[model samples]
Target: MNLNLYIMLKSSTIALLILLSGLFISCKQSKGLTVSNMKKHHIESNIKGLGDDTILVYYVPLSKMGEDYEPIQDTIFSKNDRFAYDTPSNEPILLYLFSKKGEFTRKSGHPYRPDEKHIVALVKPTDQLNITGELKQYYLDYQVQGSAFNEQYTQVRKNYIEATSEAVSIELKLDALMAINGDTTEINDLFQKRNAVNSAGRNAHLEYIKNNPDKDLAAYYLTRQPWEIFGKYYNELSLNVRNGIFKNALESKIIKYKKYTQVQEAELKIKEGESAPDFELRSLSGNFSLNAVKTKYIVLDFWGSWCPPCTKGFPKMKAYYSKYKESIEFIGIDCNETEEKWRKAVLNYDLPWPQVINKLDIDDDVSVKYGIKAYPTKFIIDKDKKILAKFIGKDDSFYQKLDELMATK
Candidate 1:
């Protein structure tokens, strides 16, 4: 089974949707919702075989909420197999229940483990939820009482677990067998079986959305699906659901999907060895003319203060800058950040390089000229203004590629 299918079904679109404001911390006087000034909703869970571990709680971010799209994250230690959590949600939304042992990815903000012990509940602001079940048999025999949407999604979730269980089992078996060079014929047969099972599961989940468009829970199901799947049955959902809690998030997804389509269509807009796009970027000191820089090479770092991976990669970036400061011109292009933050970041990081700031959103018109789709993008250009390489993420690959170029000298 493809790992992405699980991501789609469970809807990890969360980590991706969080291209928004920084996360807000709602400090609690205690786990029992003691904050009088802040909006707090509570959830309690009592389970067998979970007393030894903690529960990680995460609520889905609402893109429609404007500045409040960052979800509240918390880790609660269970006392005697029972624990409670305080979440913030003014409307009905999805909340994830992850066992600490599940190793949920914080950066991605979702569970990558397909068979991880977890629960997905539809939480409403006014309702108090109680989850009672054996952790091991959660999908088969769990009870989420006191919320209609929670009850509705739990029903859908059970069958989904059943549909994908066999595939997950086979996937684990394949993992073990592949580790020791097990039977080739057996591996091939298992691969086919898993794919078949996953395809059926995917179809069934989609069919439920198609057949029962009136249920708001079905809209929740649609939320878990990727845009390719959601676009198919969006009109089928009830008008209330179409314009309800999911409205803002759904609209955001649609706009992003359209932009992604545009980026895909304009694949040739930026590439290595091509003439660098004609553009002007200003710095605090003076006009930072691109053509005027006559260094052996130019390393253009397109970054933003809001991006974690971008700023986190600066240590290694500075090391490279220090090594090649005399031979190469290093420039940092700050995008989608306020000028104040950009200037502060330059001073805070103590970066000895030219810095240019773009105080606009990622979708601002300026980004289109360079064909940038994501943050922390970089371009290495030769003295002749031809792009040598382009990198998207802040990773060792960019530095490794730089090393290959410098080795010739």
Candidate 2:
């Protein structure tokens, strides 16, 4: 009778043990699901010496221009010299950080002078990046940690900077010389020396790309460097890196480079002594044709409303138009902008020249026809519709060329 009772108790104990085991397994699975569902990707930073300055974070793409040119910015105020950004993606991206005060200074100053108080960081989701440095050495003398790619980027950037420091110094001297109209021989010598340093830096970048084919930093440099120089490296990169966040951008660059090569081959058709490609576009005055404008000379200025350089160059264009209106025709072709923006820019700048709009999104037919790659590209055509000179950006040389051409009968 005692043995039977003991067996019954043992069976009951085994049943209870099995029930507890099932409950334990269920609870573990539930906890795992909860953890998996939680938000995981974030960018946290502790930037020292920034005080309470307003930090603006921007997602700057590789192309740096286009309809996507509008940066995705977050206005975060620094409290206790710290800020953070959270996103759902863990993919690496180019992030630019700037103080609101510095941004204002950048906008107000010469457009070409880069903001010295800004820093460019390679950040990704779930990265806890820490930047430590004084405000005076915002970009330089800073320490970054927490992401492998960012650390690699920082090292590469430091190497590049060190390699190009001599060239930068030479460039600064050259700028000063040019500002004061120094001797041509000295200026030319400085320019050549600077170019040689730049070449060395470029070679260093190539070697870096070769050594780190799998790194996203390589892909970034592939996009930033000239196609003729870095295109081969891009092909050598692993498929995984190539097809990452910058895949579409890299592909677009390849396409544009191919188009640019084609344009170079066909540039003879629009070079000096060759006839200009004729086209018609809608203007504020109404539909206008290039052939219809009869004058001793014509200035075809291809620009866009969103382009900062174009806006800066308009005042000079206006002055030139005022001086040469009697002897030459000035026409502005606005590209890749909405009608509203185009009109507003034209009116805001008081552009007296006949203005036309290119409705195409990218690589407008008119720009492609003339092999125009960048703005504000200007073409000087004679009465016989022959291309005399082509200018990429407005400068003293552009006006000098115009003067020389206008002087000709």
Candidate 3:
């Protein structure tokens, strides 16, 4: 019941690979991909032991992905261990699967981690992905038949799953040992061996991509690699592969890493204590301009709904806004997400402050202008747009500073 939260930007090699296998397939929305115009694809599964269960389906509109993203959700029910569904896709798109309200048992008292409770597919037009396996083996071991990408992903995932199997077994044993007050001396040695085994598996997956630069699987793996590795092979990819369905996703990752041929193009540099750089976003009222906002004091909250810490501070932030609404102006600059997600978060949080989205595609994105690297980054500016102070996280320090500054007000 205590499901681990899905991490959007974890840096683990296998985690990145899973994210790529399921979420990194993307395209540009401006290219005009509509449901009516798209081709439908088939997906069916027959896994033993999964009776009368539902597989939760999720996919990000490949066209409109951002650093902070959410997958659109749908579900398919399986009765008697079989199910099928159809989805529209003009090009390759990632689909993720999991059983709702289910945690497949492992050994003794530990269950398989929720993070590992997943099956992924690279769905394409006219494609039929058939998943067949024993549910107890976990989804990664599922036999996904239909495409070369599936073949490649399954092969690499085997190594990861094997390592995780051992890791999970060790974890359960460690828990049992700790519960009975058993000797924990061997536990350190076991952890060291676990790390060694996992490291070997991670290296194996990394090498698979490194050797197969021309494969589409390589594109996904390369996204997680550093520039030296990513840059070297990204160019080595075939022309079709380079400009394939993952073009936007790869390009977005490039921009995030701030490397490759886009260095000078992404050149927007500024620091605190300097005059805050001006930016603009269209609001329901009209264009909201940073320079045009006339206020004695402004609280610029740069955040995203996907970020737990960012959303966690909403109640306190709302309370502060209520107290200071008469004199201080508060602005919410939603970063690294689709506009739909931004709007949903606005309503969900009932953020009482004026909200606008940051232009992630543009060079002068507010996050870049102010050099913000963390979520819930705060900047307080005076009426003249002079940077008064800055805070990197959600803490009482920002409120403390605000109280100190507003003591006279």
The candidate scoring highest on lDDT is 3
Worst 10 residues of 3 by lDDT: 28-37
Against the hidden reference, what TM-scores do the models get?
A: 0.64, 0.65, 0.64
Residues 207-256, model 2: lDDT tens digits? 87889888777776676576565556768888998887667667766765
The alpha-carbon deviation from the true structure for residue 274 of candidate 3, after best TM-score superposition, in angstroms, is 3.2
Candidate 1 structure lDDT: 0.65
Q: How close to the true structure is residue 258 of candidate 1, measured as C-alpha lDDT? A: 59
The better candidate by lDDT, 1 or 3, is: 3
lDDT per residue as tens, model 1, 1-409: 2221111111234452332112222322334322232543367777777665656566665543323344666656677676777666676656766565443232334333443256767666677788877665222246688877777666655666666667656766777776677898899899999888767556666877888777766765676576677777887788988887767766655655555555554447678778876556679897676788875789888777767777788888889999888878898888755678888989998988898865344354335556666667788899899988887776578888888888886
What ranges in model 3 sit over 4 Å off?
1-48, 57-95, 99-115, 123-132, 137-140, 165-202, 223-233, 252-272, 281-295, 304-308, 318-329, 336-357, 382-386, 407-409
Q: Provide the clash count, candidate 2.
A: 1
